[model samples]
Target: MDIQVTKIGMVSCSGEELPEGTISRIACRKVLTDLKPNETVTICLPLFIAGGEEERKFAKKYPTITVDGCEKLCAAKSTEMFSGKPSKSLVVPDILKKHNLSAPKKLRHFGDEDQAAIQAVADEIAKSVKEVLEND
Candidate 1:
């Protein structure tokens, strides 16, 4: 039998209203682009929530990580509802709290210089990706 191992699926929040959401999205991109280019993939929440089966299908077959923006954990909840529970779930606010960092004042505009929170999130996400890939 021919078998294939899928790449890690990243499901992030679609919250455009919160800064943490932006951070979550950016961090996921950073992982996909810089950290683990060939080992990870992202599923757009809009499509995932719109009854799109592509993301659901991928999640069902592979380990997925839900990157939630806040305590609501919309991404994680959605992933669980549509597919199996994610292998790992990360909350941006929780990461910031762990690092004793404050969120940016603006929700949408993060200057290049003020990337402490973004870096924190990206780094943690990268670490999680490494762990998942290693276990795979």
Candidate 2:
């Protein structure tokens, strides 16, 4: 016998001005394509905040993880306001601080150091995905 579970929703900041925002997006893609392909779906923040879309509707019914690029936490805040609080929340700055990583300074291009930070964020998100799947 096999039991199937609903996929986790991922909402990440889309801000283009910050490196953290870029990191958030890349990490989300890693989770979807590499880490949790069979167990996750990407939720578009622009669609969710813009009013009408299937992503928001799907998020309302599933366990969602919100990834924020900055302390402002637009992704988490929007998810909470439109649906409910996310099942898990990740902030790039906080993660970097916890891991003793310096924040990325460039937005257009990333160096090797930034790649390391991105990898750390992706790893943590993948771990959270595992936790949510197991608990669900």
Query: Top model by TM-score, which number?
Result: 1
Residue range 108-127, candidate 2, lDDT tens digits: 48888788898889888988
Residue 42 local lDDT, model 1: 90
Please give the range of 10 consecutive residues that has the lowest summed lDDT in model 1: 1-10
Per-residue lDDT over 1-136 for candidate 1, one digit per residue giving the tens place of the 0 to 100 score: 1223748889999888988999899889998899877778898888888888877888888898999989999989998998889889999989999999888778887987549999999889888888987887
Whole-model alpha-carbon lDDT for candidate 1: 0.86
Scored by CA lDDT, what does every candidate get? 0.86, 0.87
Q: Distance (Å) between predicted and true CA of 94, model 1?
A: 0.7
